[model samples]
Target: MAMNRIADTTNAVEVHGVVKHYGETKALDGVDLAVPQGTVMGVLGPNGAGKTTLVRVLSTLIRPDAGSAFVAGYDVLRQPRQLRRVIGLTGQYASVDEALSGRENLYMIGRLLDLSRRAARLRADELLERFSLTEAAGRAAKGYSGGMRRRLDLAASMIGAPRVLYLDEPTTGLDPRTRNEVWDEVQRMVGDGTTVLLTTQYMEEAENLAESVTVIDRGRVIAGGSIAELKAKVGGRTLHVRPVVVAELPSMAQALDEYGVHGATADQAAGLLSVPIADDGQLTSVVRALGAGGFGIAHMDTHLPSLDEVFLAVTGQRAGGTDPTDPTDPADPTDPAGTKIEEFAA
Candidate 1:
């Protein structure tokens, strides 16, 4: 394990008024993003939200119709080669060659990056062990589980030890447990002084991994801030109290209403009444007021707004609501090669 270091003062990535268009659709409508060295910035949005377009522009795979971008302080348009040298990108699906062994796939990537044959093999071994794929290194990637394949794809991206990494929904089809494992690896990567730009539908992943978040909706940035900051934009802490008996629900609602607090909608279906509190003092008052009403509280919980709530409030749709596996949706357009599927097309 490597000790985390402070990022260099130089910004690893900066995008100023970037715009990309596909026919009549605007994939990136004057989107701006800045990523400091050795930090993580999570780009969060639903399908067709232009997350992939932004990643493609930043990674040098696609050109923007307008606006300029810089990676490692090099202009993306004029110095694409330089930008490519310092950045790595892993897309939604695993990009490893299934016919190749895990070690072979990594070694090939290392070699492609101009590492010496021996050096490539050594790097492959190191990464295989680090990603816990050493035991299966010699097995064909097709035989590896989805988690292993995803890890191998990530290891391949690190062949050149990039200073900035772009992970665009790297855990799309992964199970919950596998997703956590990938999350831990990402934390380790950022801790090792690598600046990461992540686009994920998982709100919890954003909360866990991102130092800051940029929320996009309909090809535009609707909000950008730290997790807590974004949450505050939607609302304050929620005071939830569940009475022991269903008959007491009305009393609880009345008590909450007295403080100008509105109950959660019938959609929540928590069998509890909730009110938004402005601060900890309000929380204290709510508790005191509830106690005075002689309401036997079966449970009480105060919750800050989650990223899910923030996404809903900002986008008018829930995160992870769209079926990622749907083929007909233009949000996921397959390339002619069928090897690189654009998972979030606008």
Candidate 2:
């Protein structure tokens, strides 16, 4: 593997005051970001919020109008060739050739990265096994499942053993099961020390994989922090108190209010009293109130705000909408006519 070529640096990626404009439309507006080495940093936003634009800039696929970026300790502008050597990118769609066998797809990328014929074959074999494609190594990718194709594409990106990876909404259009499979592969790579920048709108995906996240909107970063921290910032926990019988819900709500637990609402259908609490102290009060009132507690759960809730709180809208595509963010450069792969080899 060529991963040993990676530079020793505290942060695998750093961007400062990056600005990219597509004519009059500002795609990125003075965005700054940092990803600590060997961690997964999730870049989240609604559609057309510059998630892909940022990834393109970091991967050297497109240059920002102003500001600078460095990936794997190589300047994105002055040392793009060196940076490309240590980074891999998998875009929204699978980039594998449908005509090629799974093994051929990986081998071709290995060869494109300048591996010798024997070395390319060995690397292809290793990745196929690692990604669980060994059983279908000889089958054409055209017949592969969506999950299989995604895995193959991920394997191709790893052929050069890149020290950093950029995944731009890699789980888009994937089923839950398929997305979980991709998440597993990504986790495995991170376990071996590859820093990853993942751009996605799926809250569950980011919550599962990212150690920290940067939330962007309208071409700017609105918030950035650990999941728990962000959740705490957005809202407090919801205390759900389910009673043993439906008739007890009204009494439960009344008792909670009498005990100084304000904003308690009863759901008659589910027979639960929902209270929004700021901290654990309120939870103890609620427990004591229910016990003192002789309420039979069927279940109780305290749920921190979900990522979707956090997204809405930060952006003032949901994490996804039908936003028109920005002209500058072209289709994956891995197209047959593009030079992305060849540049990596160079």
**What do the candidate models score in CA lDDT, each in turn?**
0.80, 0.83
How big is the RMSD of model 1? Answer: 8.8
Q: Model 2, 271-321: lDDT tens per residue?
A: 778899887899899999999999889899987555445555654422233
Candidate 2 lowest-lDDT run of ten: 329-338
Best by TM-score: 1
Q: Give the TM-score of candidate 2.
A: 0.75
Steric clash count of candidate 2: 0
Please report, as a residue range, the 10-residue window in candidate 1 with the lowest summed lDDT.
Answer: 332-341
Clashes of each: 0, 0
lDDT of 2 at 93: 84
Give residue 319's error in model 1 in angstroms: 21
Candidate topping lDDT: 2
Q: Which residue runs of candidate 2 sit more than 4 Å off their true CA positions? A: 1-8, 236-308, 315-346
